[model samples]
Target: MTMESAKLPDGPMSGLVASAVEYMVDAGQRNVLFLDIMRKRGDQYREHVAQTAPHVLQYAAELVIDGRKLAEPVNYALVRIVPPEGVEIDKNRRPFVVVDPRAGHGPGIGGFKADSEIGVAMKAGHPCYFIGFLPDPMPGQTIERIARAEAIFIEKVISLHPDADGKPCVIGNCQAGWAVMILASLRPELFGPLIIAGAPLAYWAGVHGKYPMRYSGGLLGGSWLTALTSDLGAGKFDGAWLVQNFENQNPSNTLWTKQYNVYSKVDTEADRYLEFERWWGGHVNLNAEEIQFIVDELFVGNNLAAGKIEMSDGRKVDLRNIRSPIVVFCSEGDNITPPQQALHWIPECYADVDEIRAYGQTIVYTVHQTVGHLGIFVSGGVAKKEHAEFSSNIDLIDILPPGLYEATFEAKGEETASSDLVVGHWVMRCEARTLDDIRAMGGNSPEDERRFATAKRVSEINLTAYQKLVQPWVKAMATPQMAEWAHKMHPLRLQYELFSSENPYMATVKSLAEKAAEERKPVSQDNPFLAFQEQMSKQIVHALDSWRDSQEAMSEALFLGIYGSPALQAAVGIDPKSTPSARREMPPEHRAMLEKRISELRSRIEDGGLREAALRALLYIGSARGMVDERSIEALRQIRDEQGGARMTLPEFKMLVREQFFILLLDQGAALAAIPNMLPDDLNVRREAFRAMRRVLSASEDITGEREKRLRQIAGMFGDAVEEGDRESNVAPFDSKAKAS
Candidate 1:
């Protein structure tokens, strides 16, 4: 065979020529279609911003309660997140209230689709409400004022749903996570279960090399820039800066990947891309005081979670005041609020497990293996899996005794059926976890903590200096026109304006794109040029990522170099040798103050009636294994739902469990001693309570080992022996207690 024949193969040249021509034309048209849609996407964003920035939310909503109309006016408003067709909400069910982050963008990401937080809640038959804000803050809307307004909103919701099982289950996303936490603390009775997703409470946390956002405050010259920015904005800080900061963290995603994604699959990707961009581009504003307080008190001072923040009315914003069960959802891949930052607050705020248990605080957390910060809230799969599981099982979670737990989720085995559980699939179990487990996740480096401590002092000095020296002059020159012009000129906003039809150059692109679509062709997957194009795009993203990493390393170094110095610590009155960063010694008076309460608890071990005894016994058996699952939670809920005996509200039930658990902890012997009096004189009554108690104990699957022993001890209380240790006791038998009622 000739060499030319070998290279060309034996196929006819016409087929190859035709395929090549087709591929070229397809690639060209596809490229044109991509550009065409890109122009239109830009136009959509422009239009969306012009007419209500958060037009991305697909669910229709109606104003339920306006905060401005309240006695204390604020920008926040409570709106009922009306579900889409095919989903029905029950008013008698526990309400689910979702609060979107106000970090930069406008609201509505939570209900961005049918498969979002709101969607999952609605699908679970939860009455849903959304706490949203306006683009412009009220003249003087402080964070405290907003929290009060939200509390009022929650009050309104609760009053509207008197027949509901319990208070609303509040879910806060990102910045809103901390905001709702603040609300929960101020008005703990207003909530049932609190879910904080990707919320960074411990601002100064994370492992140095792995997480970089923690270094931002120090690297940006402490938080004086925040004050300066607000001043320059004529007392209103533009939210665009915060959005720009997020974009700067991952330029690959911001500058290239987002646009490139739409460019590559323009035909299919435009709607989704534009939908997200609408929410992303809708920037909001913060009053100078609001932004300044966030920067000075949170990011810079890190005081809220520390229990040091004093509210306007002199009430301390202590996290311990949050009585609602808190479920923290975070991710390892979340650069914005990494697991370290999200989870470390527990360790910082509480000395140990004993302290957490002492307060009867139910804290449950789950860390996603690889989802990013945004994915925690925005990903549909997460809504279906994690959130679905959460919403469905919140009732079970509410009844759990106060303690720390790590929520474990796993796909059900093949034998599992759709009818067996909530969401018909995933199995969730809460296993007890220790503070050590969280600290092991790089909770807070001693060195880094000290650096933040030093930075906090430096921040105060710089902020005061800025207010006195830089503020007056900047405020004098800054005007309403300049602020308006500056807001319009943001790079992110300008990009959209440049590509929309508002710019004359983009006028023909949409029409041309539509024309090309009629004759559109798509390139074959193996086309050499297409392959090359993908490789080049990957290289661009990779280079940008590498540059980002380098910048992160540089920022961390600069932060530590200035703030980590012994000199700086000394200058700031920090004696690292004597004073630890977060583990400072409790003042003698403070310790003494709690001692009385502790002593009272220790002394008052034997107390309460049948309700206390039953609740105590339930907690004792379930917690003996230090892990719990909802295998029998359905029965438990049915039991709670049933109007049998003295019906306990969720809070009352929780209190009984807590009071009993603490009593048991203080003096198990005394608790046992008090048990006989706790039960009824009637054997039939005792029998019924015993049967109910056993049902509760058997809810968890792990009824072995220590649990087996506890079960035997508890079974004895039924006045019958199930095993050797289960000797008949003062309590009546199961049949008698249950049958009597």
Candidate 2:
């Protein structure tokens, strides 16, 4: 071989060396950029912390009512959102108020983005308002005061839109959900329709092995630690502790995956990560009385669902008292607030479906298959779909019959029927449901209930012991300066403070990162080293996840073992062999009210003319399918709009619908027979009412199956004939002999 031939082999080796050197240089630059992003994040956190009232809301807003100025003061305030350019508000439409949860973080997650709860409502032409709070609680503030303040804010919104077609719609996200429920229960007359997203009302309710947060109280010896922590904070609990608990739930994400993703995609991911961190790092404070009541009554004691929570005024907070329609939005993939926690409250509060209707309440709940807890409120996709559908169909939900219903959505496509009727990319349908359906979603057995009850008892004992033993000394030792120092030293805060410019070491990172950005040379996507780096990152995530699983398993086993012991049950004054009671007896006054309402409805069963006849016919047709569709509702709205004469307000419409539903529910055959009497004597009026009913039935699709039979029967009662296509009609003819004269 010649020397030139030998040199050719060196050429390939040198090329490989050059590629490796280039990759290393790019990797070094990326490191600098990543660190700089972290520095900026830290700086953002510091700035957010320093603000008097920091929120992540992307919209400009004007303060409407300050809760601090209410007769009962609180830190919360209600603000009206000013629509951006090109967005118009319809003052005649129902207004919307979005309340963010005050759990750990500062408020604004509901309006964190342009495509959020507030955004969707505004896009749908509703005047929007937001309820947010300051970073610190007022001294001696309590949960009851905050709820009262919210009621005042809602009253203000109602007054602002006196000419609105309906009362204002209220949406509460997470912790705010339960707060809204409490307020609605206390003052249901002030609300129109309520949407609660990712709220946990039944705290002790959860599927075994899936929800770990519920077990934390048990493993930590109940709420004694909560009280201890409050005392240590000088009567104010640092919300960073709550945020830390949330972080601890997912070790892999918190310890590695989150930071690694930003580092790997630093060029594109920095702004998004910093935006989220600004809200995540902004911790707030809650009064000791507030946190204690939350942990004691709602979390550990599980009193809210049972109607055992009495206010300082001696009035009990019973969820059954709420008169407004409630729409519950939960998700299966939410580890923080699982479906069981969100929905089991219904069965806990009401004994059966009949009881639900007895109270004349409409409850519609939707469960997402895969979105996590935060995604329910934070994801743009969810906001555009579920929130949008709810906003556009708020009136439809409000007018639904008093019963249990499950709302589901499907994507709109060419195959979708009545696509024109759908407002956006999805179609919503609500099917009548039962208490048994809610129970089938999975919950604790009698044994599991006993265990939880025992845990609650133990928590009470521990809390009492702590109050008598350790609380006094801790309160005596705690000072404002000491509390402030402890808060600054929290791990969650330390991470931001250390990486920020406040640290002398991070100063050079900005200049280095700028230089790297100016001379950016990114490595190829197919680089072998880059692939290797990704694989290593995956391994790290897997290890951290494994560690988390092990820790959770251990905690679960310990909690169950301790709480499930017969001896422990005996010690806690609970009988291990007895089943836990899940139902509460109806108060006599509520029972009497329901009886009087039923009698009133029965007396009006044979009343009214064209409107009542049309509604009764629609309800009869809808019963055969056991479901309600938005398209049919839109058809009704169109009829009302196009007629442009003697329109019924939403409240009147709701009352008519509910009245007709109860009539049918009381006596289906008698109600059907009375349809002819309810119709006007004029032939043209009768024909128009029948056509309107048919239009609603055929709005979504061609009437077929059981629904078709029911519709034909209705047409026959109207003295009209419906054509059947080359087939013998199975629809039973209306018996003229039984018709009302």
Candidate 3:
């Protein structure tokens, strides 16, 4: 071979070396850019921390009522969101109040973006109000005081929209969910419809292997650590610790995947990462008293669902007292607040479906198949679909008869029936559910409950011992200055501080990043070295995930072994042979009240006119279908708007629906037979009412099966009033003598 031929091979080697060098330079530039983004994130965190009133809400807002000025002072305040350009607010439409959870982080996760809970409500023309809190709690503040303050905020909204068609719809995300429930139970009259997303009311309820967070209290020897942490913070619990606990749940995500994603996509992911960190890093403080109550009464003791919690005013917080509809939105993939924790409270509160109807309560719950805990309120996709559907159909939910329901949503497509009636991209339906269905979701077994009961008892003992033995000395050693130092030094906060401008080392990163950006040479997507780097990252994530799973498994096993001990149960004053009481007993007065209400409803079974008859006929048809669609509700709304004298306010409509439902529930045969009696004497009026009922029933699609049979039966009962001219009805009115008997 000639020397020139050998030199040709050298040229290919040189080119390969040049490509390698280019990749190296690109990688170095990407690293600088990533570091620069982190520095910016840290700076933003510091700026957010410095703000006196910081919130992550994406909309402009005006303060309406400051809870700090309320009679029962709290750190929370209510603000009205100013709609953005091109969005119109209907003052006559029911307002929406969004309350973000105060669990460890500062507020505004519900309104973190334009496609959020607040955004959807605003897009639907409802006035929006936000309830957020300061980073620091007022001295001696408690959860009860905060709840009262929220009630006052709602009252202010009610006054502002006096002409609204319905009461304001309140949405509580995460920790705020139970807080809203407590307030709603105490002041049921103040609420309209409630949307609770990812809230854990049944704290001790969970699947054994899937949920590890529930075992933390037991593994830590029950809430004594919480007390110590609170004391260390000098009467204020650092929310950073809660954030740390959350991070600890998925070590792979926290330690590797989260940072790796931003590093890998430095060009596109920095802004999104920084925005989320702004909320995640903005740690808030809880009053020691408030956290103690939350840990002892709610988390460890699991008293909230049992109706065992009593306020300082001696009034018990019974969830069954709330008259408004309760909508629970949870997810199967939420490890933090699992479906069991969100839904087990229903069976705890009511014995069965009959009992739920007897109390005249409407409870609707939706379980998403695969969204994480934060995604329940934070994900834009979830916000657009589930939250949007709930906001648009809240009035329909409000008018639903007393029962348990499961709300399900399906994506709208070309094949969808009555697509024009759907307000958004998804169609929503509420199917009647039973308590047995909730039980099938998987809660703790009987043995598991006993173990948790023992854990609760142990927590009480440990808490009492700590209070008497260790608390006094700790309190003496704690000072406000020391607490401030501790908070500033928290690992979560230090990461931001250390990378920020405060750290002189990060000063060079910005200039380096600028130089790198100007001479940027990005690697090809199919580069072998880049692929190797991604593979290595994946291995690291897998290793961390394996470590997390092992740790969780060990922790769960240890908790179960320790808490399930027969000797420990006896030591904690629990009998091993006895069953743990999971449900609360209804008081005599409450039971008597329910009985009295049912009796009164039975007496008026034959009463009411066209509105009542229409409601009864609709309910009769709907009962056979066992589901409710949003299109049907929209048709009902249209009918209400079109009719002159027959138009009813939402509240009046809700009351009428409930009354008619109870009448049907009490006497199905008699109620159906008496429909003709409730109709007006005029043939035209009867025809109009019958046509309206048929329109609602046929809104979604053509009614068939059992529903069609029930509809035809209703038409037969209407006789010539619906068929032709002035002909007397064949079906007779209900016998007043039989009702007296």
Model 2 agreement with the true structure over 239-355: per-residue lDDT tens digits? 999999889999999999889999888789988999899889989999999999999899888899999999988999999999999999999999999999999999998988888
lDDT of 2 at 635: 77
- How do all models score by TM-score? 0.90, 0.96, 0.95
Cα deviation in Å at residue 700, candidate 1?
4.6
Cα lDDT computed for each candidate against the true fold:
0.79, 0.88, 0.88
List per-candidate RMSD values in Å: 4.7, 4.4, 5.3
**Residue pairs that clash (backbone atoms under 3 angstroms), model 2:** none
> lDDT tens digits, residues 396-478, model 1?
78877777899998787754422243344787889998898898887655676788888888888888888888888999999
Clashes of 2: 0
Q: Please report the candidate that would top lDDT against the real structure.
A: 3
Clash totals in order: 10, 0, 0
Model 3, position 191, has a per-residue lDDT of 91
Shift of residue 235 alpha carbon in model 1, Å: 1.6
Model 3 agreement with the true structure over 614-700: per-residue lDDT tens digits: 889889888888889998899778777786574678898888888898888888988888888888788878877777777677777
For model 3 the local lDDT of residue 168 reads 88
